[model samples]
Target: MFKYFFVVFCLSLFIRQGLALWCYECVSTQPGCGTQFNWLFHWTKICPETDDVCVKIIEQRSDETIITRSCLSSLRAIRTDIPADHYEGCRPAAKDVHLANYVNNSIKELDIYRNYYDKTTWCFCFLDNWCNSSPSSNAHVYLIIGTSLISLVYMF
Candidate 1:
């Protein structure tokens, strides 16, 4: 029983460490992504720094805007630089399929990359502070409260 518990504990710790590393990597990647991509949903109204070809396809789209400004903005501000052939390589949806579906799928995949990194940045800091601080939980609560206030202020 002891051996099994020890093994499980060790595995959990290892997994946590791996997750922490992944979180750090994600945070690091965000800034570049933010600069390169734009939302297909708001493509007509906004010019994302993405490839001109993709922009054209997005703008000419007659159906739903799957890529929102939020997604594009996130990509442009956080992800890596867009590739030269990005647009040329993007496959158009079949006539039978909804355009929105394709856009949504693309945006969703991009979002997975962004979220893995972005949320990690926020959570990692919170966890680090939680672990490093001594004595009462007051400091952790204070940090959380302060960050919440700051976020609220930015939102409004």
Candidate 2:
């Protein structure tokens, strides 16, 4: 009986991993998923096989703070520039994905690559289903709070 139970448990773990990752897909307006986050039950999407991480982008332009929650595919994630341990906070948009693609495929010039951003656009990529539901920050207090929440939501 114990052996049978162990086999079932192993199978369950494999099944869970086989499923695609899900992220909160919403904009700043609509159901109000902006600076004050609102995690509605329907604000989610199962990511494609190429996309395994959830991403949240908060852009502060002029007088508007646009919050966009989406998914980041592995196409650019495999690039050599983005560090493996960059899943911490809001990363710079240009270096992480945008211009990095051009630099890697076309230019291949690392020296001329400057971190550029119009207004304040913070991009955060995480590896958990529905992880982008919250509006996060770089502060240590927010980091601690986020870690605890992740422990409860994903790690458990």
lDDT tens digits by residue: candidate 2, 37-153: 655434467777654677666656567777777766632453334334446476645443444344444554543443332544445555555677664522433654565555445
Give the winner by lDDT: 2
Best by TM-score: 2
lDDT of 2 at 47: 77
- Per-prediction backbone clash count: 20, 0
Score each candidate by Cα lDDT. Answer: 0.29, 0.56
> Model 1: residues >4 Å from true position, as ranges?
1-43, 46-51, 55-75, 91-156
True-structure RMSD, every candidate: 18.9, 10.9
- Least well predicted 10-residue stretch by lDDT in candidate 1: 118-127
